[model samples]
Target: MKRNKYLILILLTWSLFPFCWQVYTSFSVSESILNPISQIESRWTLDNYIQVLTANPPFWRYLLNSTIVGTLSTVLTILLAIPASYAIARLKSFSKNTIKILLLTASLFPYVLLFLSLLEIARKLDLGNNLVALSIPYAALSMPLAILLLSSAFQDLPLNLEEAAIIEGLDLWQRIRLILIPLISPTLASTGIIIFLFSWNEYPIALTWISKSELITLPVAIARIAGSSVYSVPYGAYAAATVLGALPLILIVLLFQRQIISGLTQGAIKG
Candidate 1:
């Protein structure tokens, strides 16, 4: 038990060390970055954050773009997944395992493999540089995992409850709206959060699809900030922007952590 505890502690430190260093760097004066010990002695300032916020492209605009894309993608994924999951969970038309495998295989195909084709399709469809356009691919990419999770949650629910609702004169949509959804709410939240994170952090897709400054999402904007060669790279500002970019996700997990945990672990026990 002691060994396990020590191992966990070591792993925790290893995972958090880089973030801690970034936080330190965000506040440290530029000259202090090379000398770790001098970080404590150097004057700290909010100038990094200010610079990031006031940059030509504007940090808040990138944040807004991320929010729009992530929220829309998650909503679309959930809407599409719910019926598909219910059909898979309750229907006996085909082997559930086979269907699940096919869905997983589809999702496992690397996004990079589809990149060029998707970009061409986007241009042909006049979706290039459109925020809503980004959501389509994001939703498609995340659909499989969302469907899998929702199917598991739906399967875990008692069939008798659904049958009872049917006997009470509730139609299919009514039963799903009032019965199954409430029971699987936790799983839905977990799935939505995961999809949102995927969309929010996606860079390669955004980088390829969006060329206009106004449409750029946070990840792509941050990458551009870090890669700027026109001016000396502002390490402090870059670290601060990274922290800002990550803060929303951190707060979201902290807020819904219990639901996320419960949703993921719901079927682990067989009793």
Candidate 2:
């Protein structure tokens, strides 16, 4: 146990080294992009965070756009996924392989292949480079994972509880609403946090769909910092923005850590 503990500590040190360096670099203001050597060679200042927070392009707008898109996308995806998962787990009206195939189809379908089609759909729908377009693709992309998770949650739930509810004269909706949903709520929380983090960190769809500067997500804003000058990028601002963008996910992970780990572990064990 002692040896295993030491090994885990060593692994954790290696894992956290880069993030520690980033936190260090984020406080450095030297013109040399705030690297390890720069940390050793120069003095620390708060200017980088200040510049990142107050720069003309304004990082806050990116935060807002990302938050809006991430939130809307996660919520809509979870809502859509819940019913689909319920049907798959409870009804089984369709073949299980067919359900799996549809999920795989949703996930494996190349987004790039359908880019222009999605663009036209976005334009026709008048969603137009904001949360709507970002959310649609994000919802589509995240649906598979959500279904897989909630379906597992639904299946893990003891059928006895469901049957008892039904025996009490509760119909399908009441059984699901009063029994299944409550039982699976922890799993739902886990899935929501997972989906939120995925949506929050999504990059490709954001780049493809969003055009206007004000509408661009934090990832795009951070990319703009990479092009701060015609040929040069401020790695300092890039690193800082990365840390900022990750802050939300960090808080969310911490909040959901227990339930997320429990649900995933239980699901894996069951599967």
Candidate 3:
């Protein structure tokens, strides 16, 4: 038990060390950030954050772009997954296992493998430098996991409720909207958050797809800030940007931590 406790402590410290360093660097002056051993107390300032937030390109715009893309992609993923997962969970016509396997296989392919094909398709569709274009692939990429999660959540639900709703003249949509959804709300929230994070942090795909400055997402924007000039890298500003980029996700998890944990555990264990 003591060994396990020590192991947990070590792992926790390892995971948190980088984030702690980032927070420290964000508050420290540029010189302190460059020299890690420098005493932060004498060199601390908010200039890095101020500069990052109020730069000419504007940090808020990047945040907005990320919010839009992540939100739309998550909504799209849920919209597509709900119907498909419901059919797989409740319908008798389809082979659930086979469908699940196919979805998993589709997701298993690395995005790198599909990057060129996606780029070609995006160009052919005239979707260059567009958030909707970014969202298209993001939605598709996140759909498989969303479907699997929703399917498991749906399957865990008692079929009797669905049958009762049906007998009461509730159509398919009504049954789903009124019965299944309410019962599986936690899972839906969990799935949405996961999809949002996937879109929020995606860099390679966004880098290839978004060429315009205005269309750049937070992750891409942050990367650009870190390497904005050929001569110098702004370590202090980079740290601040990294912290700001991660703040929203941290707040979200804190707000819905209970639901997220319960939903994931239930989905995994029940099905």
lDDT of 2: 0.78
Q: Write the per-residue lDDT of candidate 2 for residues 154-271, one digit (tens) a residue.
A: 8768889877887799998788788888778778988787777777777766786788888888877787773487666666666788888888888888887887677667768777
* Model 1 worst lDDT window (10 residues): 34-43
- Alpha-carbon deviation at 125 in model 1, angstroms: 1.1
Q: For model 3, what is the C-alpha lDDT against the true structure?
A: 0.88
The runs of at least 3 residues in candidate 1 whose Cα sits more than 4 Å from the true structure, single-residue gaps closed, are 37-43, 230-232, 268-271
The TM-score of predicted model 2 comes to 0.86
- Supply the TM-score for candidate 3: 0.89
* TM-score of candidate 1 to 2 decimals: 0.91
For candidate 2, the 10 contiguous residues with the lowest summed lDDT are 31-40
- Residue by residue across 46-134, what tens digits does model 3's lDDT show? 98899898875799899889999998999899999999999888755368888888888887878788889988998898888989878
RMSD of each: 2.3, 2.8, 2.6
| TM-scores vs. true structure, each candidate | 0.91, 0.86, 0.89
| Candidate 1, 74-95: lDDT as tens digits | 9999999999999999867468
User: Model 1, residue 231: displacement in angstroms?
Assistant: 9.8
Candidate 2, superposed: residue stretches over 4 Å from native: 31-35, 38-41, 91-94, 108-110, 226-231, 264-271
- What is candidate 1's local distance difference test score? 0.88
The model with the greater TM-score, 1 or 3, is 1
Q: Candidate order by TM-score, highest to lowest? A: 1, 3, 2
